[model samples]
Structures are given as structure tokens and as C-alpha cells.
Target: MALRETDPPEVGGYRIEDRLGSGGMGVVYLARSASGRRLALKVVHAQYADDDEFRTRFRREVAAARQVSGAFTAPVVDADADAPRPWMATLYIPGEDLGTHVRRHGPLPLPKVRELAAGLAEALRDIHRAGMVHRDLKPANVMLAEDGPRVIDFGISRATEFAAQEVLTQTGRVMGTPPYMSPEQFSSPQDVGPAADVFSLGSVVAYAATGHGPFDSPSPYETAVRVVDGDAELDDVPPELLPFIRLCLEKHPKSRPTPDELLLLLRDGHVPEPRPLPTPAAEETRPVRRPKRRRRLWLATALGAALLTAVTATTVAVTGGDETAPGDLPTGWQAWHKSSKDPSVDKEPVGPSNPFNRCAATGRSLVCAGDDVMATRFALADGRNTWARPIDETADDLGASTGGTIIAAHSGRVYVYGADDRPIGHDGMSLTRYTVQALEAESGKVIWKTVTGDGPAASEPGTDSIAIPAGVVATYGDESQYYALLGADDGKVRWKRPLPDPDEQPCMLRGAAGHAYLICTLYTGSDITGTSVTQLAPTTGRPSWTVKAKGGDLDLVGQTDGRLVLVGWTGNHRTVTLINAKSHVLTTVRLSPAQPEEASVHLVDRTLYFILEGGSVRAVDPSTGRQLWKTDSTVERSSRPTASGTRLYLASPSGRLAAIDLRTGKVVATSPGRDDGTLLDTPSYVNAPPVLVGDALYVAYGRRSVYTVDVRDL
Candidate 1:
């Protein structure tokens, strides 16, 4: 494959020459050192760079591969597992992997299978002598070099003396490819020894000759079941090689021939007379979790299994200065829930299109806004609604609701929309003109208020105005759309410019990382013609760059590591687009296995978290376009997650709050729904993502209620 435009030019003095491939962990590149020695470099993805657990695994892999040295195994050449994007380089073996070779051509001939079998056995001997067991041995992991087949990718390997693998074995968390795994590996991983490699070698040899494994099945779970049940499918194997392969796949680990013994059997060109096939394990020997675990029985990398076991959430602040131990919350912080209401005491949710309440933290308290309430400050230490400010009583009708939404809060100032008095228009009718205001945080007094675009109302959150790192950008006007960048302190317009209107329709303005973007869509009747995101310069209202896509359904959710993340729905799947803010390089991803119709997505720390309406959550790596894990929970119809450390904070429409473990995709803890059990204040708005500050999580729910939940309590 060619190197992608987004691929790094070099890593740790190694110049990237070509693209090799990519896996769940990272991308592999064909690189060369200063001496021009060719090597294959594996660079970890940016998303996993900050992941402490993943870095530990990368270090272990580097150490394990460094210990083993043989012609049959790819030797570690150079490595720096501590680099920003951790990488390890190994000898560049010249041929394609056995799996790809077989896919391009047919199954290997008898002579080549013998060569493959002999080489792999020798590789196993070298690995075992180094006190390591290659847990994952499959055709894809075996390279058919000119000299022999070389075993590679020791990422999941373990030392015979390693007790860490033993601890994981006690739990139901199983790893390794199902069809290629040994029977003993599935039944008792803690008891796995060097013989497990011999069994996998047999499976790899069988696949080389027959283009399939002896325990192949449509689904990985079914394949795992077959392997555990000792159901071998060997009809396609050559008669001469059947006995040799059979001897290696003995159900009992003790019965399986060791790598040393396998080398003796293949010493000659032909095998001796076949011994009787070993008896299969009885049904009683199968693990007890098999039958009851049918829904998601197989524990493997594919189809979203948990990446790591859930650990207790940590509350270490990202801010510099003070630090705390794991699970320690900020001083005086307590989990509390409260609610308020619109002046009319509305019985149901005020807005059917967008959520009513939203919040942002400033200094020692949280400033919030909703459909009915203009602005309210909640104590950060508790859930007290310190002060509430309802929408001004204007004679003219306000757009969306009487209350304005909070655009942002910073430097002890809260930015929100306010309604100017109703005045008769030129058409002899009372008209409402919205005003954008900057209010002091201590008191509900406007510092400055300006008339917003006298155009159609923005019913959705972030459609009309959004806060950038510099200040707030408010969109106004109809047909000819215009946006102005207001100074954060003075509320004075820093710059004003017209936004493109493809079909004479207004474009939505959004902000991310101090950058302003104009989301434009052109439609013909009910069908969308085109969609594009044109980023505007923060200092000046000038177009920096614009990227166009097919249709307008996609939304600009967030940005991470200088890449913008846009999400859209297609059929039952969601398409995620990652674009480099500077390079303009685009990478599109289609979430596999499809998602529920009501599924929502959020991006944080370069990872995409998707939540289904029924509460199934999926964590996907946006860089690699792979789903890390999927977990089932009951935190239904929750808002987009506010990520901190290894936990995700979210709230449901009914004010139910859930703290999810980011590493394991498990629900750590959840607070009960509102005592009043009302959804009027918290409408189900996709744009109203949750907010996390320090060790406290502030969420708006129920009838005008804002709650503060401490991670330590969860």
C-alpha cells in the first residue's frame, strides 16, 4: 500500500519509505535507519500514545521480541517504546504473510507445506527456549520468507514464568485468534505451556495446505466452541500430512508433541505410519461459562470485547500544581442533585427540537442556561442553584423559548442570548430581535448586549453562536449569512464577514479550538445536494480552508490532536470523517456492525464513543478506524460523554447520571433519576454534550435542575 498523506515522514531517525500495513495497535511502515539498513517500523497511533496500559504492552512486546533471536523469527532491530508515538523496528523479512499469499494464490503445495511446518517448529523451539510462548500463531502472523516462514508479532505473547497472564486467565477475559488457538489455551490459559505453540503450529500448517483451519467456523465464537469441543475438520488435508498434523492437535496438552519432537518427526521427507487419532475431550471437560455465555461468549479482539479490565476511576486533575491519589476528589466536593423550573411551570419539555438546559463551569461555580431560564449559577461544591435569571419579560415573542442557552463561560463572565423588547416592524407587526449579551458571573448584570442577526431563529444548539478559544462567534442574517467574532471581554466585534450560502440558505456557525467554522448545506426539495465545512480564521473572519462532502447530514462534533471529527448517519451505520486542520487530508470511517438508529457519538482524546438508544456503548479509535470495545448498559438516551482520566460522565433525559469506565467500557456507577422524574428541563439534544470540571461533573436535567457529581463518590 502507498503511504497515506497523513503518514508521518519519519520516526526516531528512521525515514519512512513505504506503507506496510496497520493493526489495532498502530501502523507499520517500511523504514530505513541512518546506515540504510532496511527495517519494518511499527508506530503506535496518536490516540494510544497517552494510554498508559497500551504503552506498557508495547514495552513488553519490545522486550519479548528482543529476547528471541533466530532466522525463523523476525528479530527486533531497534525500538523506542517511550516515544510520543511509541514504535519498534524489526528486520524486514521479504515476502508477504502466509495468509495473504494463500489469498492471492491457492493453498501451498505439499513440498512448501513441509518447509513451512519445519520452519515454524524451529521458530517455536527458539521462542520456547527464550522462556516465551507465542500465544497468537496464525497464517496472518507467519511470513513466507525466501528461506523459511518467519513468526512475528509477539504482542500477545507471554513468558512461561509470567504470573500476570495467570491472573487474567482466572477471569473470563480470553485473547488470541479463535480458529488458531489450542484447546488447552481456551480451557485453561493459566496452564498453557510451550505445547500450546505446537498445537497452533499444526493449525497454521493445516491452513497453509487447505486454505482453512481444522476448527474453522463462520463466527469466532463458533470456532472457539469447536476448538474446545475438539471438533477437527481435516478432510481437506493431504493423507501423508494428516497423521503429523493430528499428533500436534492432541486435545490434552500433555499428549500434544513438543516442538523438539515435531522437528524429529519432520527430519525425514516423509512421516512414519500414522498412530490412532487421539480421543477428543468429553463434554464435561468444557468450561462452565460456554452455554450461559452464548450472547457474547467468545473473548477476542474482534467485535468489540473489553480492551482491559475496569479499574477504579482516578481523579487526578490535568491542571498543573496540586495532585491527588487515585479516586481522590477535590476538597469539599460532594455529589448532589437539584432542579428548577421555567416561570410558567411547563408540564412537558419546552422544545421538541433541542434540549432545554446546558451548563459550563467558570471559577468556583457552574453557569447554566435553558429554554425557559436565561442564566443560572450552581455551586461547584454542591448542587445549589445559587442564583437564577429567567428570560426578560419582552412583549414580542422570543425564538425557540423564553430562556436563552449559555454559549460559554470564561474569565468570570457568562455569555448567553437575551431577548430585546418587542417592537413594531416596517410590516406593521411586532417583531423579536435577539441580543447576545456578556453578563458578570457574580451578578446577573449584562456587561454588553448587541442585536443578533434579525434572521430566522436557530432552534438547535450551536447553530447560531458558538464559543471559540478567543471569543464568541454569532451568526446572523437570512439568505446572505454573516458571522461576527466578538471579543471575550468587551463583547465588541473583532471581525465580521459573510458566510457562503450555497442555495441562498443560511449556514450554521460552530466553533472548535478557537477556530470558527461555517457548516453549509444545499438541498433540492427534500434531498441534500452538497455539504461543506469552511473554517474561518479566529483573528479575522476569513476562510482558512473548506472541505466538501457528498451531502449535508454530517455534523462537526469536535476536534482532537488538530484533526476535526465529523459524524453522519448512513443506513444503520455511522460515518466518521477525520480531517487534518492544516494538511486538509481526509480519512473516512464507516462504523462496522452497524449502529442503532438512535445511536449518538462523541469524540474526546482522539477516541470516538458511540452510544445506542438501548444503552450499548462502543469505543472506536478514530485514527485507525477500529472499534476498541462495546459494552451493554442501561444508561439509555444519555448525552454525549464528558471524558476525564479513564472515566466518561454522562446524563440521561430524566437526569440519570452514569460514570462509565473508559478502559473497560463498563458502567462504574450511576445516580438515580430525578426525584421528581421530569424530562421537561432536559430535552434529548444531541448537541448538548456533558461537561466535566476538575473532579466534579455538572449536568443539567429534570425541570431546570443542575447537579454536581464527584468522581470519587462514584
Candidate 2:
């Protein structure tokens, strides 16, 4: 029966205020208690109120509501299961429901979706832990309260006290809203439990993240079919959160994560915080800037004033607002005075200049190499222009320095720079400009340079041979010959050694400290395999030891402290190997078993981070050989992850930066990406790692925009 203005004299002592909204089974009214507490009174229709079976179910719902009623759920204010119009009065929740919010705002950002997922999981845990099952859970039953979310209207909810007839009736009857029902709820509702609620929560979160439900269909019948027999439509969900939700929606309810388990997962993923609870006044109104009456008057007067001023003030004197000014110097960042934009193009700047190219940091300075220019150095703190000199213009390959002095050989030149990046000099045979260069630390002078035997070169900087030290430079070439000696200054031979086979492949440099490290793959002349790290002393130029590392394609980042970090990828298995430079002790930690793909390994102090081909990232501790955290960036396949202090940053190819709290493996915040969506769509092969100078993250995109995001704000 429709609730009319004069239908009820009173409902459990409080008079009906007005019809709030109505659904198929009942009419909800805005009501108040004698003490003036607001409530939503759901009075059952007369037709259903007399049905004994329906009354029993509603009684059970009242019991369930009383059990779980708290801050996270709608508390029961009053109810009369035996009344003529069986009614339930729940403390009114103020705010748009999930469905209404999605309809109004479109899809929420990933961060908000994450918070919703976590909050719902916690809510479900509370309900299930109390031994109740909200079989008819759906968006309409959820109130987006300010403090978090509050589950409401538990009319068909039940506990574990099940009779066969009750189960069968609840199962066969059209119990839940079809659009939000779970598979079991549709095909066999009797089997539904806490997991069914989880399934519905999944749908709610999906709808919130992407304006459609997980099993959306052209028709309700099709959507039910998909929920029962097909895969969920999760295409729009963030890749990082997809795996967790998939586990929640598993076909077998038992296979799905329990509410507690879901909480743990969300905790690990660092889900965002729940929105604060709304005060009573806040709930009564959508956020407004002014009093309703005043706003209308102000609007009329503003329009009248605009009309009078428009004609007389034709020439508008616009004042510039200095809102976009660069922020204060971040920690560890040096105060810089030069223009942050590209440097002057007209000045005949001296030295090897590398501008508009990728760069990596050493200690506190930035060392970058570029085309037609020698590698240059700049104070990472302040972006101060350091000394730059000329390297062979034809050189294409550039390797980031480890300590501060050694430059890996590229196409032709191996240019060396002092702490200030001033070119000391160059040395080599006929390929002086072509060989790699090594300079001393104290003086801007060339130490030693090498040009190996001329032939079809394997890869530039052949395998990782050169180790530039205080007074010595080590070189290992294709001929299996090793040389460790003082350069032009000392003119003293330190050591010399040769390998077993001079014709073997040139060693791929793995890493180095006082000893030069190389990963040599011993071919059995069959299938590709058998790779080992060869360690040779820098002073003696002789084999110190060899440790078995993971076989396959591996990128060896230089030695930090005493550990040699190697990112090894073999077919479907990805492993990171850490070898102690002194003891050659091998420790291997497997990352994703996806595949051996193009990847990069970057070390920030103690933690080692790697990026897979599809743009997923894994952080590992080399010392313990333990996996820290892994996240699918979904940006671009080639975008690299960068780390500073304890914060790790990953920017999707579209310029969305996901800042992860390293200690907890949780995503703290994400920036709304590029303003121009189409620009990020332009494919570019050159991928750049985020430069973390301190609290500020500087990254360049496309050709013109160089954006900086404050990590502290996130």
C-alpha cells in the first residue's frame, strides 16, 4: 500500500514525517522520535506484511541489525515485527548511496575506490564476524556516510539459523536486485553466506571505480547470466587492485578471501583512508557555500551588477595571480639560480654537454650523457650547470657512473668527469675518441683509457670490465686479457691475468668495487644457459672467484657497499641475484614468473627496485634476498620507477604517478595525470625514470612540459 499523508496515526510512538522514498516492498518515511532523533521508517506494504513467511524474514533482519548496529552500520532505533504494517526504524544515514554517487560523479578515482574497497571489507567483516549474512546486500542498502560507509536496510538479511524450507524459499524466490546479485544468490541463494555479501561489495566497488557493474549487460537477464556463467567485466579497474578483487569474486565462495583476509590485502596495498563521518548538519545538506536565501539574493544582485559593469569596463585590467610559482627547496636539493627551463642555445658552452637526455644520480650529483655531447655533471641539489667537454659525437651508448669518476664506453668515447664534471683528458690508441674513458677523483686529468681489438663489436662497454679506483684502472677485453695498473701519473704496473679461453665471448660487466665483476656465460655449444659472475681483483687483475648466479638475460647494476645486485630474467621466471663482492656469496630472490623481458634495476641505498616489461614494479632487499612489494603501474610498458629516501614513485605512461610507501607496500596517493589525454597517447619509445631530488619529483614528458609534483602533498 502507498504511504499517504494520513495513513498512519503513529509508528511505534513517533508520527510519520513524510514519504522519503519507496521501493517495491515498502515505503520509507522521514520520521522523528518523541525526543527528535531522525529516522528512516521502512514500513512493509500491507500485502507483504500479512505474509507469515515474509514477517519471519523481516524479524530475522531486525535481529541482525540490532546485532551489528554501530558506527559502521545503521543502528536500529525501533521496530515492530508483529505490527499491522510490520515496520523497521533505522537511525537515518545521511549522504548519497554508492549508486547515486556514481551516477552523479561518474567513476571515482582509483584512490577513492581503494578506500571504498577497504572500508566495505571491514564492514563486511564486522557483520560476518557477528554471524549474520546480508543476503540482499546491494548499493541501495549502503549509505555513503561521512565517517566511512554504513550498511543499511537489512530487511532480507539473515543469520546461520537456517531451515531447509526457509533456505529453499530464499533460494528460488527473486530475492535480490538482479543488477547487484551474486551468482549463488541468483542460481542457489540457499548456499549464500558472508561471501555473497563480499560478491555484492565487489560489484559496488566496481561500479564506483568505473560507472558500470562488474557483470554489466545490455539487459538485466544478460547481466544475471554473466554473473552466473561468465567472467566479470573488470576492464576499467586499476591493474594493481584487479588481482585482489578477482580473488574476491572467485566462482567458489570458499575460494574467495574472507573479510579478514581482504583487510590484510588492502592493508598491504595501502588503501586510501575512509572519508570522515558526516555530522548531522552536514548530512542534511549537500555541501553549500552560503545560506540558501542569501545565495539567491547574491546571485540576483551579481547578475544586475555584471550587466551594468560590462559596457563601461570594456578594457579589463587582469591582475596576474602568482599561484604557479616554483616551491621552496626540497630537502637534499641544492638552491639553484639558473632558469629551470632549457638552457641558452646560443652560448658556445665548452666541455661535453649532455642536455635534454636521461640522467642518473651518484651520491648527490647527476651524471647524464647525451648525443653529440660529452657526459655532464650537475649538483643534484640545485641543478647547477657543471663542467662539460666534448666526447665523440658518434657515440650512442651511455652508462651511468657508479662512484663518480668512471664513464662506460658508448659508440666510441668513454668520457670521464671529475666530481665537478670537468673533463680531465682522453687516452687510447687510434680509437682514443672511441674507447671508454676513466679519470681520477682529486684532479681533472685523464688516468687510463682502452681500445680493445677491433672487430664486430658485441655490445658497448663489453661485459663490465673497467673498475676505476683511487690510483688504478682495470680493463678486461675480448682477448681474455686483464690489466690492472697505475696510469700516466704513477706509471707502475699493479697486476695482470688472462682467462681460460681468449676466444670466449667478452665478459658482460656485472659490477665492481676494488674488484671488477663480469657475468660470463659459458656456452656448452647447445642451448643458451650456464651463466656465472666472474670476480677479478682490480690490483692484481687476476680471477678472485666465480659465483653461480641465475642464468638468462640479466642486467647487472653496480655493487653497493659490498653486494652485487643482478636482475636476472629467464623465460617465464624473473630472479634478482645478490652476490657479496668480497666473499662471492650468492643469494637469488625470484620476482614475477611472468617472463624474461626488457627490464631495469635501480638501487636507492639499500632497497633494490625493478620494472618488468608490462610496467609492473617489484622492490626487493638484496641483503636478505626477500621480495618487498610488487605493483602493476599500467602507465606505459617502458616507464621506469624511481626512488628517493623511503618513497618509491611510478608514473604510468600517461603521467599518472603512484607514490608508494616503501615500508608498508601501500599506495599513499596518486596524481591525476596529464591534462591532455591525447598527448600521453602519443607513443614514444624513450622511457625516462622519475628524478627524485628530495621531496619534489621532477619528470619530463612529451617535448615541452616538465612537471614537478610534491611528494609531501601526496
Q: Which candidate comes out best when scored by lDDT?
A: 1
What TM-score does prediction 2 earn? 0.39
The RMSD (Cα, Å) of candidate 1 is: 19.9
Worst 10 residues of 2 by lDDT: 309-318
Off by over 4 Å in 2: 1-365, 377-390, 393-432, 438-459, 462-468, 471-506, 512-514, 527-529, 549-567, 574-608, 620-627, 637-640, 651-658, 669-710
Q: Could you tally the backbone clashes for each prediction? A: 3, 21
Candidate 2 local lDDT, residue 696: 49
For each candidate, give its TM-score against the true structure: 0.51, 0.39
lDDT per residue (tens digit) for residues 478-508 in model 2: 4325544433223244454554453454355
* Model 2 C-alpha lDDT versus the unseen true structure: 0.52
**In TM-score terms, which candidate is top?**
1
